[model samples]
Target: MKIVVSGQMLKYQVRNSSTSRSSPSSYGTASPSSSSSNGSQHDVTLLTTSRSNSLVSLNSLDSSGPEGDWGVLKVYTSDIRQCTDYKTIRVSTKTTARNVIEMVLTKFKLTCRDPNLFELWMELTTKAEGKPVKTILRLENDAKPLELQRCHPAGMSRFLLHMNATGTLVRVYDHNICAASNYKSLMLSSLTNCEEAIDLILAQNRKSREESANYGLFLTTPEAEAQIPPEVSIVSVYVLSQPQHKIVIRPLDSL
Candidate 1:
């Protein structure tokens, strides 16, 4: 009925108090101590988002409970304080990235000074080269189920959950972040063709193509035009990816 998520107090109110035991969450749907009046429950379907920068852990929830979206997720933390759960988790495919983090807080039975200021980053990479491609999961869709918004790579069931910096609105990162709130950058190899480039960009910017009617990947610089023959090869084409209304430029200095 009523779901409330904030920077602190992780609580989820999907089960009816009558049918379920009283569980505690700092990122709560209802007040942690409050329950249904006539013994009713809320139906909440979790959704997906991208991991931010830092990481969380696994031992944050009840792993022995009834099976839901039972899968493995890695929480990469930089420090002891960042280590919220075990390095890995047994999660459900039905759950979202936001729900996973909240579940972590609930699993740890801890509270944060600012919890809503975090995000989930789905790191897309290859098994061969370990190429880094990141995507920002929408934080607002905590209530939506992942069935419709699945970002997990095929055959690669596991996902990553990263945290933002504390006491700051800015997210600090040392590497190239391919995904975020809006537009993100991704690298295309010289051998990648136009079709392959489109596929690569779309894979990282799922939210982008969904929102814009005029989305495309092309060369924006005259320098590129001069070097790339009119032959139209992926090696010469740089991507100007737009998610929603934001423009993401790749080949940084090229354009």
Candidate 2:
């Protein structure tokens, strides 16, 4: 999707190339590579911002309003850059993070049967090296946005709505030589394919891609465990995975 913010055009898509760099205000760097075993890639941007140049009326919600039963909350999606594309909603003290998500989806005309498929996060901005750095914290379902806002200083935080990986929670471990206790939980978006997941996993583990070319993803379920191909979608893997499913990464020699 494309949107105009601050007289500049911003395009949002599930990116695997470095050609498209996010604005300085964005949380993280864009995807680094486009190499995927899967011939096709899904169109899903993991994180994006939208707030400026909004078509929605801003009559009722005001950011400067005092703490009360009702307040305004700005919600950003993954289609545009920071504070450029957003939907403003009037929230109450009774409003939960899940409630905000439903409002965002409905206002944005997005269709999703499961509200749990999405999550609301708090974006804390701090200055580092003369640039803004963002820290994201997932909000609990019962957390109140309006009330929470009062706890923080002004302009220090904002809310962002993101899609949660619908797949089973997979714990990735090193080869058998490593202790079983050493594992990293991989909970990426369902839109992430196996290839992107692999890159993301390697990045998280701080392993060099050039050195890990022989590594593969293995999915383990209560019924069985098997090595997954790079072409597989995370959604497809989820279908085959049970609640106890996990993804184990190992070199080809260790398999």
Candidate 3:
């Protein structure tokens, strides 16, 4: 049957055959204490059969909030073929996004394991009672609990390197080539002349090998080269060896 909840414009449609037997207390009274003061006890029940489906829907609404300024969004169960089938109702209020997200996570028995994916968006609205409504947080289908592992300093650096290596490389003309005029000029000139300047330098140091060694020289593509800023494109090389001393060497052309 179609159920239109007033005060909040919430609506739901539940199948009549799915109603189950439920206790009067499970129907959800405004004040349980007051109801019990009359020497009445209520029992919790589920509405899965036709007889109690209406009560179940009403209880669901009651559990959301009292009937007044703001009420819980109605749940549509008529289209649901199975008893366990339920749809999420979007809640919009003035509550903080963080709090709303936390509440939703708690309701779903979920924990924030991935801060990156735990993003929350909220909209603010004034309630009829002149009070701020609670924030409505939405969860994307991809959102799930993520466990983040703490990384040590060394591990963090390695992770950063991996991220950089795998990330898309954007070639900024000014930042990559214009600033490093001297280096670009040298590399370009070498390319034009078919001169293996870099390779020759490696050969002079007896570092040349058919198999790429850890210290072997390699060619950087123009696209890769473009990522180097012009200011850093100068043909200057640095060597670090034993004794913790560094030696600065310039290209042969520089001499």
Candidate 4:
């Protein structure tokens, strides 16, 4: 059996165990598509990469007609410390900043309780006092991404997908021992502390606060792992978060 799952940034190919191993298939230089065939088990899991930037025509890149060809937009997250690379997306002259933000969230498979909690910003870098200074310009919801990119030079400016300071979207793992990808997204206010975040997750699951005391929110990353203190706000932890960061619920006794 063969199955194909497609997303904005990835295309996954799944095959049954009977098939012979094959060389990976590739697409283009700037944007490459790859395929993997595994034949050891009944099921195969396809992995996603951060390098799937599709190609577009150079002339069509700046077209702004009502029926213009597809254009490309480079998007990156506000979490610069961890997410150092930009993601490429296909956009048209009609695509707005809000629409690009939604596309990015979907590409990353993140669900936010409030989509409005996110915004797009234009980051401009200039030299002042013999030093490089960075300025961020917030884009309106209706602002066009393709047109905006056309206005600025490639190296001097960039588009950033940022979470509003008002609140942060958090992913919470369920209270299970297994390492499962199924999780819930919660909109946490900037002032919400670790303890409050736990309560919110429990409430969403219809669990009681009494059980919350027995649980703790732990953050794990490639470099290090630690349990978040009850008094620390979610925004604080979020600032130091990485792309692969995870906040999981573990029994207090296990910690």
Q: What global local distance difference test value does model 1 have?
A: 0.36
- Give the TM-score of each candidate: 0.29, 0.39, 0.16, 0.40
| Candidate 1 residue-wise lDDT, 1-255, digit = tens | 433334332233333322222211211233342444443554322222323332222223333445545656664332224434344655564466567666655455432212343444332322212222222233333422233224445633233344433322211111222445344343333343444334335444443424222333433332332222223434333332222222222332434
TM-score, candidate number 1: 0.29
Model 1: weakest 10-residue lDDT segment is: 167-176
User: Order of candidates by lDDT, top first?
Assistant: 4, 2, 1, 3
| Per-residue lDDT over 136-238 for candidate 4, one digit per residue giving the tens place of the 0 to 100 score | 4567676676765676567766777766547666777764533443677777767678887776666656677678788888888877778989998876787
lDDT of each: 0.36, 0.58, 0.24, 0.59
lDDT of 1 at 242: 24
Q: Which candidate is the best by lDDT?
A: 4
Tell how far residue 167 is off in model 4, in angstroms. 2.9
Sorted by TM-score (best first), the order is: 4, 2, 1, 3
Maximum-TM-score candidate: 4
TM-score, cand. 2:
0.39
Q: At residue 20, what lDDT does model 3 achieve?
A: 31
lDDT for each residue of candidate 2 in 114-163, tens digit (9 for 90 to 100): 35567787765544343344445567776677766765688877877766
lDDT of candidate 3 over 117-166, digit per residue (tens): 23332111222233222211132222211100011121111000000011
| Model 3 stretches with alpha carbons more than 4 Å out | 1-69, 73-92, 119-255
Better of 1 and 2 by TM-score: 2
